[model samples]
Target: MKQTIPGLIAAIMALSSCSQRTTTTNHVKVKENPVNTKVTEQALDKGLFATLKIKNEFKTGEPVKLKFTVYNSTDSVKEFCKWHTPFEPLMSKYLEIKEANGEEAAYQGPMAKRMMPPPASSYQKINPGDSLSVDVDLLKGYAVQKPGRYTLSYTGQGMSGLVVKDSVVFHILP
Candidate 1:
């Protein structure tokens, strides 16, 4: 009976320790701070403008939504291949994300090192005074996992020169 009691006590201690570790590892403590929405815009060399918008606060483990828009003010049409945008190939050539510590987010997927002949239909043509917008979940699209402040920048270009470039900031909560 004495041996049984000691064994039971040891089992309880082990279980308690395991539970504590699990809770400690799973619970993410976030620092509370007042944040404001960050929005920025920049005009490219051409008559194009780029805008970036992001929320000030975010919940930990939740996807961060990023909104990017490109506006063309020129009288002619602006054309870009699918590889240059985040449409099908999901390329990030123009988009850049950096953590608060200035560490840039690494590109998560395979990047095209060389230009390939894309299908004719893969080209997106924007008419004059038109705009193109993209909504992306930063977590799934960019592998943003930690809860902290992040900066996002976008540099869009056409076959010519620079089209648009802008940057914004956002925060992730616990």
Candidate 2:
């Protein structure tokens, strides 16, 4: 009888855990809708410019690739890097980043490691009339699937704040 009671208790505990695991309630309140982000053209090709172009419109859980082009007509070579920021502007006010395919996206590392130092930016040098290309993996952790417009920009860490020489607006439809 003692052995049977212990087994029964274990079974009940297991059942309780299983039930709690899938107890997802849809009573969570919804957040306010986001605002539209403005898209502007930067003549980096003419002077110092950066551009982000995707192969196609992105969708939730859809595999995609982004092509970034940095054009520097200046005397010095411009540097560039990539980032996935989802919380800025709270959406509607500006383009924001969100999880894609139900997964968070960003270079996994410490803040110092992920963000480059001023003048020692993420991108390398792009000399006069020179252009640089980078391929971004849309899977394996880094993706945004909220289905909205996003601004992918090249920002350089500067003394004042950040220098955004160029940017592009892309859309992801649900």
The numbered model that scores best in lDDT is 1
- Segments of candidate 2 deviating more than 4 angstroms: 1-47, 75-110, 113-123, 138-143, 146-167
Q: Write the per-residue lDDT of candidate 1 for residues 147-167, one digit (tens) a residue.
A: 788888764344212333447
Q: Model-by-model lDDT, in order? A: 0.57, 0.40
Q: Model 1 off-target regions past 4 Å?
A: 1-45, 113-119, 155-162
Residue range 46-101, candidate 2, lDDT tens digits: 24444455654677777656554444444443343223211121111111234433
Ten consecutive residues with minimal summed lDDT in candidate 2? Answer: 85-94
Report the error of model 1 at residue 86, Å: 2.2
Ten contiguous residues minimizing lDDT sum, candidate 1: 18-27
Each prediction's TM-score against the native?
0.62, 0.40
